[model samples]
Target: MITLSAFADEISPLPEEQIDVLARHGIKHIEFRSIHGKNVLDLTDDEHAQFRDLLRQNGFGLSAIGSPVGKIKITEPFEPHLDRYAIALKLAEFYSTPRIRIFSFYMPEGDDPAIHRNEVIRRMTALAGVAEAKGIRLFLENEKGIYGDTAERSHDLVTAVGSPALEHAFDPANYLEVGQDIDSAWNLLRPQVGHFHVKDYCTKTHKNVPAGQGEGQIPRLIADAVAHGYKGFCTLEPHLVVAEKFYGFTGPERFGDAATALKTELNARDVSFA
Candidate 1:
């Protein structure tokens, strides 16, 4: 069965509210990104303990640590970012999840990503080593302006890293935003994808929409993956109310809408989700 999870903080900054919304939507897991307006990497020890207790009480497991592990610029200092990656690993263990979402570093604007390819691979390799040592899987997300933003580059980074610890976090809307056809990107990255972020994109309006409402072609992707026996987390990352570089907001009601949109797709395909 595909497990249903979400970036619950998109519903509210408060942890309690985040849990409440997820429970209401029948989502038993969360892609833990933030709580109390703080990133998961920045959560203090006490806060971590408290949040764990809350999750335990609410009967929620974690799908992954939604860490910004590789969102740094390719030119930024690396040692500090590695320390942050360590924290993300710790959170993954604390939550008893083997998954941590990451990214390929951003290339300088207007420059060909090839110029930064070697550096990105070096940094990614270093990170993958840590994940491998810790027995954690890193789901490298393809984000706009990032080196792995395209299916081809994402395939390259995953192949070059060549680590069992590294895999792809496929986001159809992201590919659409970058002008890649969703079907083509899916075909290219299907073998490497270990996670999914459920959001749709309207090519005509250049806006994010709920699943099946736009050009993302989400239902077909879901049907295909299920037919292929893909069992994994499909995390709802609805940027319905606001889509920003660092964070997004959908609010409680729209977050519910996003969940419904995803559930509808699953239902149409006769797929079960927990």
Candidate 2:
């Protein structure tokens, strides 16, 4: 069965607000990107423990740690970034979660991606290796402007690494924003997808929209995923209000709207989700 989760941080920087809105929508898990305006990776040990307690008390579980582990520029020094990645791994263990969402490193603006293909693979391979050693799965998201933003390159990077610990966290809105045909991207990358990010984007308006109200083809993707026996988290990441490079915010009401839009599409397809 498909399960529901979300970037609750989109609802509010306050943990209580995030949890409240999610609970109201029947979402019991969160993607755990940030809380209190700080990214998950930057949370202090005490902060992590406190949040863990709060989640447990509220009967919430973590679907994944929405980490920015691989969002840095490709040209940045790798050693320090690798050190930061270790923090993400620790967060996963802290939350008792096996999954973490990540990105392919961004290519320099105006540069040909082909020239950096080897480096991207090399970095991804390294990241995958660390996760594999810890028995954690890294879900690589196709963020706009990243090396694997397109299906073909995403496929290439994943295949080149060839690590079972690495898989796709398919984001239809992201692909749409990058000008990829959703159906075609899905056809190519579906087999590797281990998670889904439920959101939609309008290429024409260059804005984020509630699911099924934009060109991301949310309904078709959901129907297709169900038909293919896909069973995993459909994590809502609606950037309906403020879409930014490192994060986005939808506030409480808009987050609820996005949640309803996704549920509407799922109900139309008779898909079962928690």
Stretches of candidate 1 exceeding 4 Å from the true structure: none
**How accurate locally, in lDDT, is each candidate?**
0.90, 0.91
| Local distance difference test, candidate 2 | 0.91
Tell me the deviation in Å of residue 146 in model 2.
Answer: 1.0
User: Root-mean-square deviation of each candidate, in angstroms?
Assistant: 0.9, 0.9
Candidate 1 vs. true structure, TM-score: 0.98
Query: Model 1: which residue pairs collide?
Result: none
lDDT of 1: 0.90
TM-score of each: 0.98, 0.98
Poorest stretch of ten by lDDT in candidate 1: 218-227
Tens-place lDDT per residue, model 2, 65-158, is 9999889999998889988898989889989998999888989999999999998899999999989999999999998889999999999999
Candidate 2 at residue 18, lDDT? 88
